[model samples]
Target: MTTKISSVGLLSPGDMGHSVGKVLVHNGMPVHTCLAGRSERSAQLASAAGLTVNASFEELVQQVDLFLSIVPPARATGVAQQIADAVKTTGTTLIYLDCNAISPETTREVGRIVEASGVTFIDGGIIGAPPKVDGAVPRIYVSGPDADQATILNNHGLDVRPIGDVIGHASGVKMCYAALTKGLTALGTELMVAAEAMGLTGSLREEFELSQSAMLEHLEKSVPGMPPKAYRWVGEMEEIAKTFDDVGLTPKMLLGAADMYTLVGQTPLANETPETRTRGKTLQDVVEILNEALPKGK
Candidate 1:
């Protein structure tokens, strides 16, 4: 039987939310969305984005066949629980889609919640960046009992790929990869900060200058990206570190990565950087920012 997906309701409609809805609407799906608040501005964004603004969560649940969730992991359960509490008994063939960066254990727990409420649950993990404003293709990986529902999302023009007959595998891959890439970037940022603090900054920069270490490239790509994303990555990183720590898989490096990312996350840099809006990597710019914040006596 073809799983029909015509309408999608997105909770917490922000950048990713708006991006996903745009993709869905572009591909002929009717998307009803919500914002951080019921502010008039939020409604305007929804309207400008071509999404029907729902007055309440109940309206979203009652009208949509598929629910695509893209909130943070810590809140993933809360979002699911909120939905389940309201519409779990609706006897509707609703497919609850969770594409947050949560753990397998956490996901299984979410599954239990929806399954208990008689809702069809699908575990989804999004891998690539958000849907394109122009023509970029973002990948969304999904799997679970009715994992095939991911195909419905393809209506949005995403490169949808199924991992296997389960939810955990897709999330597992996403979490670990996030740990490595984001983890490494975090570790690099921290180490760089420390190096600068110790006057080894020049030495390290020389090393990069001498050997052309890829850290520069990483910084060029990572620093700007991490600042805005740090808040979200910190929790996920902690989760990844804990996952490895549970089995004693030597998470020393990853945890450090988490700490570093956590630090940069300390201050959310607006627009990645308003100082040199066009500069590629913060590098010296970031060093100045860090040093100024430090006491001179140290």
Candidate 2:
């Protein structure tokens, strides 16, 4: 039997969620979101993306064919619980996809929560940035006993791929990938901030330019855009750390990375969103802020 997906209910349209909702809407699918307590920016994104706003979760669950949960890692399980309770109460059986950066353990926990309510649970992990109409669409890798249900999104402006017939495969991939990418961002921030504290920013940059140019350039490009996102990454880093420890490997590195993101998240710079980020921000500026807030030998 083919799993039919014609209507999608997106939870709280943030930057990434709004973009995903836009692709669904553009593909002729009816996408809806609840805007009850969302920010003004969230409302603007949903409106711009052509997503229908539901007055409440009950209304959203009653109408949609599928539910896509795209949120921060810290809120992933909580959101799943709310959706499961809503579906159980309304007697609505919907396919729920969790597309957050979380550990496999967390993904399976969410699966058990919704599946117990007779809702089909699909573990989904999104890799890459949001989809652009004329550009690339991020790969949404899904896995579970009912993972094939997610293939309904294929040809609808999303690259939907199934990794295996297990709940955590997709989330495992996300955990490992972010452990390296975001972990490197944390590493770079620490190194640069230490250099700034030692009054060696210039000398360090010159040395890295000659010996580690590729890494230095990557840091320069990525660090400036990370502070505003650091708050969300804190939970993601903790999830990654858990993923590692669950498998019997050392998780100290990512645990330290989580601490680094915590510091970044507390800075005034974290208030800037991608739409309202500081103009001409640089890596040096990021280092100076961290150096001032968390000096060496502290």
Candidate 3:
């Protein structure tokens, strides 16, 4: 059944949310929003976009046909439970789309809460920053017991795709890919930071300029994806811990990497912090090696 979405209820709209909500309204979907843990700015932003901002989260859930949970990972499950409980009384088939960065386990838990209350759940993850309000196309990873939800999202100018099986697979892919890509991001940052501290930053920058700069290039483009992604990484790290417990290997190193990424990600230059730090670390490490190789700094 095509759920003709005449109205869209946006919960916890941030920068990405504000932009996307505007896009929805522009696409003929009257957007209503609610602020749970959002600020006055968020409220104002939503109001300017012709969206009706409600006072509480519960109000948002009850009024909207489809609920989009775009909060931090730690808050995703709690919010889902709260909304699911309220919807149980209404006996409405609420289609809840989870677009938070979380583990497969958490996603399954969210599914349990919503599905238990007879609500439709779509396991989904957003992969990029918000696109242009008009003709915006951000890649979305969506999977669930219901395929219709995915189709509905796709038809609405969203780049939505199924992740297969249950909701867990979608979240799992997000967690795994984030760990590796963000891990190296932190590593490069650490190296650059250390090098600059030792006055070898210039040489290292030159080395990167001549040698492998792909890492540097990738870092440059990916930094902005960190702000929205960092808070979620903390939760994914815990999930990685659980994954390690299942296997024989210890997650000591991975855990440390997770910590490192979180620290820089929360900073102002998170967009530039990692790369700047990496430049320093590389110069220092390389300078030391070169000095030793050249017989006591010749």
Candidate 4:
């Protein structure tokens, strides 16, 4: 049986969530969001994306065919529990998708939460940036017993792919991929800040340009956009650490990466939102700001 998703309920409309909702709405799928405990910024984004705001989670579960949990990785489990509670009480058989950056074990635990209530649980991992209007949509990879149900979202401005019929497949991909991508960002931030402290920023940049040009370019594009998002990535890095450890690899690498993100999240740069980031901000800007914000003891 093919499932048709005519409506979706997006969990807090942050930068990524609102854009995702916009894509669905543009494709003629009605979208709604619960604003009960969200920020004013979230409310603004929801309004801009044309998302109808539901008063509470209770109302949300009853209103949509599916609910997409696109929150920070750390909150994924809690949100799943909340939705599960709502589903159990209402006895509504809706699909619940966990689309956060989490580990395979974590995804299964979330799956257990909703599936117990007779809700269809799909483990999903979103790669790439949020979809841009009239631009590219991010690929949402899903796995689990009910993974194929998510395919209904395809051709509706979302690139939905089914990796397997195992709950953790999608999450494993996300964990491994982000470990490399975000791990490199942390590594670059560390070296750049160290160079700035040693008054060797210029020399290192010149050297990197000569021998590590590709890496340098990646840093230029990735590092500047990291700080404000660093807080959210902290748990994701930890999740990656757990994923590595579970696979018999040493987790120390990503634990260090988690520490690096922790430091970045405390800097003044972390206060800047995606909307408030200066246009055309460069790697030099990020390096200098991090240099000034590095703890005095270090």
Poorly placed runs, candidate 3 (over 4 Å): 1-4, 224-232, 236-254, 265-298
Model number with the top TM-score: 2
Q: Count the backbone clashes (under 3 Å) in each candidate.
A: 0, 0, 18, 0
lDDT string for model 3 (1-298, tens) is: 4455555676666656666677677666666776667777677777766688777656666677777777767788888887887777655556788877777777888888888888788887777667465555666787877645655545555667786757776766666666677666656655665575567878877898788788667755554345434555666666655555545567675687677556645554333332133322333443343233332333
Which prediction has more favorable lDDT, 3 or 4? Answer: 4
**lDDT by residue for model 1 (1-298), tens:** 4467778887655557667887778788888865545446446556756888766666678888888778766778888887787585455557788878877777778888877776788877777667775577667778876777768666566677787788676777777778767877776676677787787988888888678777677775676556656667767776676667766687677667766655665543523532235532466666555545455785
In order, candidate lDDTs are: 0.70, 0.89, 0.65, 0.88
TM-score of each: 0.87, 0.97, 0.78, 0.96
How far is 150's C-alpha from truth in model 1 (Å)? Answer: 1.4
Ranking by lDDT: 2, 4, 1, 3
Q: Over 4 Å off in model 4, which ranges?
A: 278-280
Better of 2 and 4 by TM-score: 2
lDDT of 2 by residue, 1-298 (tens): 4557789999869978999989988988899889877889999999999999989888898889889999999989988988888888898879999999999999999998988998888999999988877578899999988888888777577889998888899999999999889999999999999889889999999999999999999999989978878898999999999999999999899999999999987787778888888732799888887887874475
Error of 2 at 18 (Å): 0.6
For all the candidates, what are their Cα RMSDs to the real structure? Answer: 3.1, 1.4, 6.6, 1.5
Candidate 4 per-residue C-alpha lDDT over 85-142 given as tens digits, one digit per residue, 9 for 90 to 100 = 8887887868998999999999999998888988888999999999987799888999
TM-score of predicted structure 3 = 0.78
Comparing 1 with 3 on lDDT, the higher-scoring candidate is 1
